[model samples]
Target: MKRRWIPGCFAALLAFAATAALAASDDPSYGIIAKHKANSAVRISDEGHRIVYGSPKTPVAVEAFYPLRAGGEGHEWVFEYGYNLVTAFPDKVRFVAYDIATPRGGEVWQERGLTCGAFLINGKREVTVNGKKLSFLRSTTMSGWTFAQLKAAVAAEIARPRPARAAAPKKPARPAKQTVIHVTVPCGLAGPYGEIVHLFRARHPEIRVTTAANGIVAMLNQLRDNKMTSDVFIALGLRELDDPAAQKRLVSGSITPIATIPLALVVPKANPAGIHNLEDLTSPKARTVLTYTPNLSGGYGARQALQEAGLWDRINSKIVTPKVPDQCKQMLKTGKGQAAIIYSTCLKESYLPDKPPVIEKDLKVAQMIPQNLYSPVVIGGAVVKTSKHPAAAKTFIDFLRSEAAMKVWLDWGFTRLPGA
Candidate 1:
């Protein structure tokens, strides 16, 4: 599915190789491979043809399609930006791409940035992943160096000793040990990081709170192993907090609910599939999109809503379960899914400041599922007992319940917990 395929910058890059170069129904026929060599962009198509481009912003040719193997999801037609090139990966050409992220699935989500090469996929996306992606049914979900990071690194690998250039002035070392506390949450809940951290910093300037959103499973594994990428774990589900607390991975009684998120029935722009409500998914015309199985973090609420509606058995087979929520959105944005079940906060996550989220042009909330359909998802967290910064962790965790932080959370579409 879409790897938060909201293409804008390099930050959101991540996903896997699709079958063949692309799906049969897609256009452009072949994706033009791009490379940086000798200060020029070399664009090469599948037919062994090549084009030398001088400008960094030249339009790279591309073909867009979905692999039938990716749960039979549809192709995303990239806009004029033509990020559709990402659909045709596995070209075996390694380049210093993305900012570099790794691993997938943990008590927190640790996902490989992406197996394919899509452009800056965060703001004003070039293209989105709107299909069901190949889930890691295999043992290894994500591992190893999937992409290059620097041209110098690649040159070093080739044993090419070039003339040395003068080194630039060294920058200052990390400022005298700020009490940096890393907080990991699902991407949808990441929107408030700036505001919350800002307010916290206003009073606790010595403490630095860094927040990132990913699958909770990926982060937890790191916590369990004491890797401690996170000092504070704010998750989309309470199970994440409870399970670790049960194992004594966290400080005693530190686990607590931070907020609750309601569910939404999301549809693509213009309601192309004619899905006006949840029940419409059962019809031949609708593709009820879902997050991958083990739905703890991805399609957790969608599965619940359908089951609560007594439509699970009837609509289960027709669902396309992507590996993540972004993938589900991608399927819809690229013209695949009829409806996606997701947290209402997800709308806030993808909302553009220029327009309201409910009126999002690419995807719209078709229905706001009643709370009676399912229990509100409890997003909670705890201070890691094994943390390198325990005091700072507790400080930030405590700040989450503060009046200031609660305002940011609510602004980001979360409901404040009782007595928070």
Candidate 2:
């Protein structure tokens, strides 16, 4: 009876062992190993019941596989894994396992478990698991962590209590004050400068810019006499800086080019004289208005354009010289002249019919003076040495060269200088 009982018990034990082994083999983790084993791209082999897999195309150089047998339930499978050096994106290491189960009942190796960590080759401690928020371990040898050690590190981080955050300190009250940056721009630049100032003030509400439109020469003289307090001087030409008085007032090596102003032939809305181009200004019947202040860029540019077209003498004969380019626009609108040679920026401003007698009509820019004959007016600025707000002044000057400011200049009919 004893011998018969022993035989039956031994047979039962053998059957139970076979059933457990079959269950382990049927697990999703084992399915992933089997799938990779058949994949030509992944070189897989088994060592002591452990599935080892690697691929040159994969970021993971090599990884050892194991299943979290205790917690695995149906499609929900977890993996305890480890990897050696990652060839591609070595800083970030990810381990992924697959399963074959879906509500749609499709047979495919779907992603089952994934864990990622970062490491540095230079032996610094910056390893994070899953994301940067959950930093589990920091060591030089994180890449070499064993499966047991990696699992333990993750468990420790999850179980550890977070430290209580300290209360934030009260912020000090800010003083109610604004710094003013006095800037002198040419009369021809009033429109563009107004837009630029508006944008600058919007960005920096702490600084206030007081702008004055005057001849560049007059602005320089005021700087010399200390009559007008200015932080910056924006001139239409670099020649303005050549003045000994301006050179003395401005900081050395602070002059920088901003943009180039092209000359445009502006005509009245009706175009009563039928002047459409530079050649049209040569007509004896054409009453062409010319800017006279040669020191001002628009005045200089107008003369240059007419001289290049070989109509300076012919056109100059019918000239009604305005004090400035703004006056030139005024003369054309008031019917004092049919056409005027002025800065393209000035012509753009004339479109606004805000001022009465300035009708809402299409004042056309007939033609842009050829750049070959007369170069575009190159505008530049310098920080005055005597500025009360020197830092704010320099900040404003830098803003003038910004892409946003350059776009405003372009929209106003000026071209940005190369490297400006």
Candidate 3:
């Protein structure tokens, strides 16, 4: 899918904003909300509404809904919450159902709903679990939680009488067992590279993976900034076998090239630019130009190729550098740019049933300038030194290169690496 950021009409924009506000209202306990605070590593508002705050992926401000009972009452009460997903990204909330019994065996109760990682509580009831005091006024439950069994333990704590403590403050409840491995994959909606990483995590239960498609360059820059630790980098072959800095960061000889992505120059299938080869771009007759943004690592590779051939000056004269591949394709289709350079895989994908805004054949993969330095950019994965699970990281990387995983990458516009 070619990514085009078509500015929404004013009415549509208003509707979206209104929807986001309503979504935020689902959990209303307001206070200093800590991140990764509980066993789930999720922060909650000081006055527990049972609302779990924080994004499963880089949580902005707890958006998933968790309606809590009034005043944290332990007595049975109905709770519900609704979540509005942002259109820019896919929002998937896993729901978990919990059944709790008070220590006195007063009554059997159940809580259920869908949650990203935490829930909201709004009532007056207080429960002590693992020593720390927790309050639940309004209770909201989520669906699809893997640790459904933990809720009962929580309820028992709530039902028991308050335990007396010495002069010392109660010790904080130990954080959840077996910390999850956070793997953020940067791939666009049209690309399947991110999905491949998810599969790798599934096969290895000990590890937990989270994926985000921040475009290739943004993803790399994120790693560069150290905001997040990517246990493994998964993207085009060029990202792995080509980048000098990327190569330097790898454990010596740990670079595993699993697939290849061909580079192609494209224009709206209309061929408005009449772009032919390296020489035509410099003719000064070309109108608007399109190419990967310099900020992206892959864009850097493309620019390097241009500089080596002495076409940088000519190309830079008429350039449109979009942040991601999808945006690059959109520029041409919407007539924003007369021509664009993108991955050949995008062209093949354009042939799919609901083709992107432009036809594939109209955009030709400009012949690789001085084909000697030009080769399909190999895409693959590697274990990062910052990863806590070195063994698991290496295992995941090896799995990506394995025959079973290669088939998936091969189908997703990646080619076999040289000498693989």
Candidate 4:
């Protein structure tokens, strides 16, 4: 009977060893080993000796791979392949190199951005804690990093000591207070400033803000028609602010300017039509020009420029009107005309492939003639007088003017107003 029991124990020991091996196998090999920088929230991967950041734009050379032990549910080595080089450690040993791999083999979806973190089979990313993985994970949101860096960060975390746990404190009798705010913002400038809004939301999760990108006139009409929506109104023209009807509809002391935008001339690159100055727009050679329909801001700017140039008739003949700024941009991109008179901001936002052909080069920002005719496009925010959440709207507006909040808007090429 004792001999039989010995055999049973031997079998049990073998089974335990196999299970351990399988768990260990879940960890990666020859992949991201570690990250060096803390403030640099970039993800990384390994390509043999080279470490690559997730973004294709910024690749740096990696010096070494320091592997770490994987515990609990284990980590998956998902290689978003790209020819990007990244450094493992910045201070001790900063190795900056480039990734030379071709685009054919790399993951495409993450070309825009990438990060590596605890993930579950249900398609939710989680946060790794102790030996166990926890749920309710916050998504890793970031910019300015390539794919290779993401992989290296995972490896580095494994090698480093786990973050020290803090002692659980006694529960407070009162719950932490949070402020909720609501705001209405313009849709046109919304996309460029999304990061700013997101940052503000992170701080004041209670704030329920909304945005609409419709033209200014349309927004005012909505308010007047009483089909109004949103806690705040953001638009371009100042006339709305001074209007008796609009003033009556707006909450007192809520109207304020947030940013100042300058007018600019948008033309195709090289200006083949010899349209160097505003006067050139009237020359006989100038056959076609891009502008928004008479109703839009771009069209108004074009009209003003022609008037200043003293050749409204010459420029008018070449008017190629479009309904929207993006539409006019598209027309210019396709070489539909030589140039389009548009806002400088629109020109800055237009996307053209890197190193485009000469014909595409014609699309660009042009200098204005004498006096420059700088049109001050003011973007303002106001609380709707009829909004049910008037207090919330005020809180949201305050968040937009916060020091932490202004940085986001500044990044989008907006100059904050004196009070904003």
Candidate 5:
């Protein structure tokens, strides 16, 4: 998640602030930041205060990301983004820091421009000190940044007045009606689920979503045993819905097409194996990991592609099938496993066709499995039969097929069914 995403476009912790008459006794209260328009700027005081955004649609979340001194020397930095508290120093740096939630609307957030409280939004105020550019964030969706860049930004933002502070945005609260729905999707979609589910909640605030990302097989086992419960099941492949185990738990008529994803052969950015094509996987030198669980769908797709290429027998020996090959991107990056075949959209270069390529820094697609090589897998969703919120569950399912959800799916690299 290393971010080269917003080079020219920077989202500062700036929301529009109303001037307070130098509050009596330096009362610390930051102004709300939701840029109604550009040309407006915020005046940031050194006082560490919670910056509030006044939009009713935006939840009144009080997540504290305010800057704090790490040591007596003030040499280290501590940033709390939601539940995760990150303590960082210049000497040693951890690669990934920010956990991005879904952005509101790209066009809207950008157009409103920068506001000032912790950082500014919707405006461009790139502060360059000692030739190092200050890059902090790109909306709520963050990317990995180097320590130097982070240090520079921290120094610049917190420099003159006081300390560098990062204020995290909170979503608006839900209604008291208390109609909640639990959603289960594959682990691969967890990241996108943040954005997609956010969109769903925005449109339907009355329905609370508690999401769980697990493999279809695990879901099946849990469902049959009554250990797991989900109002909605967004599955990887249509075949999962057809399984007897799944069918018993899901309402047959409630199932619907979500998206179609083709398999991809991915490798680390280093490309140590020098793999360029599927046929290379047959070489004894290569070690590829295929998902052993067809219940997961990724493994099923990989096996299907290899069989279609007539390389299943030849490369079968080279494949390393772990019991739960859930982390393909990690395996490729960590050298735990050299190569893997997973959903092409699992980690993408771009979420939208028109957007800049926010290539996943650590990995890349060595080769995309030809659509003709095997039958492409279709992602589907259905309502659980045992759900108490059946009507609400059905409503959520219907939302998945809506134009809004389709946009989310397409932006994340899923293709719509040809006819539907």
Candidate 6:
């Protein structure tokens, strides 16, 4: 009454079962579906998902919109994905991606990358969707999946209808207010600071920033006395932070370096004294202009460099102490001094060749002190704890460390901090 199954038939059935199980297990939504399902506020629709794929070595950024059921308004969520260059694969294969979401209007919250999910297919070919974990078929396993495939999968999942919920009462919207942040920095940083502030404003139009450029000592003294109306202080060196009074003004653990300006010698366009090298400054005819020692960062850097070259004492008597780096350049241009030592960025001609004639004329970088002989002047900043716009101040400070800000620093002939 019972028939025995053939060996080949039994093997075929087993293979079919394994394939079906693998297909059922592989869900490549990158955990977005589960996350949306769990959160009561998140409403996913077919029109709300976007995916952008990047070439190798670059990052992929995704923007997803989830409308709030209460207000029928939504916020865009940005997520980025890339390879983790610092941590090798199998240990930490993917760059942690974060989502920028505004919980309340004008207030932002950054969600951690892992909680959002990851598409890691190297050593372990797995996709995390919502809270459910799945893996790709072994036959289909690869180091990474195409952006198109992932996007299609996610789009299909998000298109499915879900249970509707009741709308909650909407809270009245508050009028947007502008936050003004006052920044104090050394005059030597005027060029880079201008560019950084401009870019920061462009990125955050709701926040207004004003900058005051003065000598570091004067700025520090003003900050100590509360005479300066500033929310951020950018100094020439870390030593400025060591001052007890200045330290108290800074928000704890907020000191961050932004850039470095190298010491350079500026000479007249005519090369009146024929000053070209460090040794050339020793000539009696070398009426050199210098920054005042100890107080001026550029002056201190120049003195250190000259001392290393064994030309400090020889040039000291000939020195004309200028109040600022700009003054040093002016002295050289006006023929008041044959040579001037200042921060390399002070001479616009050194980096900005296409600058206007009035600003670009009559001064050239004669020499740049080698890094081995003298260190560059560091530019750093900290948020004042007394700042009324402390959050905005911190955001501006953080922007100074962005790649766009670093480009501005580099364009002005200043050295960018590593990993900035």
Candidate 1 lDDT tens digits, 1-420: 355555533342322234333443242323222222322343422211112122233222122111111111221222211322222222322221211112112211112222122222111112212232211110111111112222122222234343665696785564476876766555455446445665787888788665544444445655666654567777777755545433477778777677777778888668867887878888888745655444463355667778989888988887787644456666666666677777666655422222223324467788888777765678777876767988888888788777888887787777876444
**Model 4 alpha-carbon miss at residue 348, Å:** 3.5
lDDT of 4 by residue, 1-420 (tens): 999999999999999998976755554432234322233455554543235444443222222111112110111122222112223433222232211111111111012111112112112222344464433111122112234334444444435564565696784442255443334333345444445656766676666333333344445656676545456777654444666777778888888766665555667666677777677776776678877665444466567767766778666778878643446666665567776766555533311112111122336677642324534456667888778777777766676667776775565555567444
Residues 312-411, candidate 5, lDDT per residue (tens digit)? 8987776766654444455566687677887777665322222344557777788989888876688778888878797888888777768888887787
Q: Write the per-residue lDDT of candidate 6 for residues 263-331, one digit (tens) a residue.
A: 777787788788888899887778555565555556677778889989887878887785433455555
Superior candidate under lDDT, 3 versus 5: 5
lDDT at 410, model 4: 66
What is the TM-score of candidate 4? 0.49
Task: Give the Cα lDDT of each candidate.
Answer: 0.50, 0.56, 0.45, 0.48, 0.53, 0.54
TM-score of each: 0.57, 0.51, 0.49, 0.49, 0.57, 0.53
lDDT of 5: 0.53
Per-candidate RMSD, Å? 15.2, 31.6, 19.2, 19.0, 17.0, 25.7
lDDT for residue 131 in candidate 3, whole number 0-100: 68
In angstroms, how far off is 67's CA in candidate 1? 24
Model 5 residue runs over 4 Å out of place are 1-178, 215-217, 349-358
List the candidates ranked by lDDT, beginning with the highest: 2, 6, 5, 1, 4, 3
In terms of lDDT, the best-performing candidate is: 2
Q: What is the lDDT of residue 418 in candidate 2?
A: 52
Model 6, runs deviating above 4 Å: 1-175, 213-217, 239-242, 349-359, 418-420
Candidate 1: 10-residue stretch with minimal lDDT: 136-145
**By the lDDT metric, which is better: model 2 or model 6?**
2
lDDT of 2 at 317: 71
